[model samples]
Target: MTSPLSEPADDVIRAALKAHGGLDRWRNVAYVSADVAFDGVAWNTKTREHPLSHARVTVETGEQRTVLTPFLGADRRSSYSPGLAAVVLADGRVERARSQPRAAFVNDTGETAWDELKLAYFTGFAFWNYLNLPFLVARPGFAVEEVAPVKTSTGTWQRVSYSFPREIATHNRVQAMYFDEEGILQRLDYNSEIFGGQPTAHMLSGYETVDGIQFPTRREIVPRDQDGTPAAGPVLIGMTFTDIEVVNARA
Candidate 1:
């Protein structure tokens, strides 16, 4: 027997792509970069390479550091690498660590995922589709289901959710996605609770057309706390890309 979930969602997805960027534009590009800001504060910068899934993101405040050569495809090969470490709270003050020391993180949507840098890398690559451009070309890998009507300050949003399988080197992994009614990519809720007890939500806003591409100038991440409070408001940081250099002009 055939399942309705397994049926083609091409029309719905195609609507989203059109509202996002347009298939013709998306299919013509390779790599992209963006410049971001928040309330006049200079946040981090990001650049991504596609078809290869290699991402290089730099976070700067006083110290400027970068994550290089990260794998960003559906294979889930390399998440966070050795050099990709974190600083976490120890006793009262914060302590520097090589990686996430926790076992699992409880996200806003009630899902848990492994806490690691590799997961973060995969997240960046995943968001590149909606955040960087409205159009994306990739092998369809999941069943789409209309979830619910999601309303937000932006507008009334219709939503459809989808999921895919990921085989972590030693663990099993799965990713879920949510798209708006207009077919706009709205939110991605991941279950990797390795950072904290909260799910990490990578969201995009301030959509505007630039150079024929729909790009969001603002990127915000909200991570949940142990007791389930949305913790502090976003870090008031902004991201932007400039001087974008495409690796292969004609790939």
Candidate 2:
């Protein structure tokens, strides 16, 4: 059966599968781990621990990459509180920033990635049937639309843009993604003030094979406008993965 999104030019399904690690490998995957870095600095490390039910995440930053997960029933729907008094949501109901001691959270109503990260898991928004992908996959209202291909340093690829959700999280904005014809995620573009360093645009390319799974090892971030166009003297940042753990079926 052809999906509603199926068309001659819209061969994104076939392209997506082959672009990723392939069907057999994608369906069989359990968990994944990658050493993450930014600006030549080992800023952090990340792990996507997936169970048959839901996925968990452990992100290490600062000096060491720490292993942290939602406190179970505590994190439901659109709120996350991990250890101590860290609270994150798409509605700005809780206060948890170390810097913002008394800044009452202003409810701005839009797409937010900070709240999305609290739930763990990354990408897999459109491809993976929206199951066992990441916390962001279940965000309240994300508008997905297929757009024209945009030229990049790599090559021509199809683009899928996600609009702002009705609710707002700790992070104000969200980054959009670009997928290739083979459905392999090629580039991700977004404007993140919290993570993108400076109001910047980010591009992830150079997909390589590691442990039989196709992963984007090289990522570049540069300052850009709200539309993702690089500014003058665009700074190029890079990241590479050294070790990886692809799901533990026994555990």
TM-score of each: 0.50, 0.50
lDDT of 2 at 101: 17
Overall local distance difference test of candidate 2: 0.40
lDDT of 2 at 198: 50
User: Candidate 1: where are CA atoms >4 Å away?
Assistant: 1-10, 35-138, 165-182, 224-251
In model 2, which regions exceed 4 Å deviation?
Answer: 1-14, 22-24, 40-142, 163-174, 181-183, 193-199, 232-238
lDDT of 2 by residue, 108-133 (tens): 12222223333221221111212122
Q: Please, what is the whole-model Cα lDDT of each candidate in the order they appear?
A: 0.40, 0.40
* RMSD value for candidate 1: 12.0
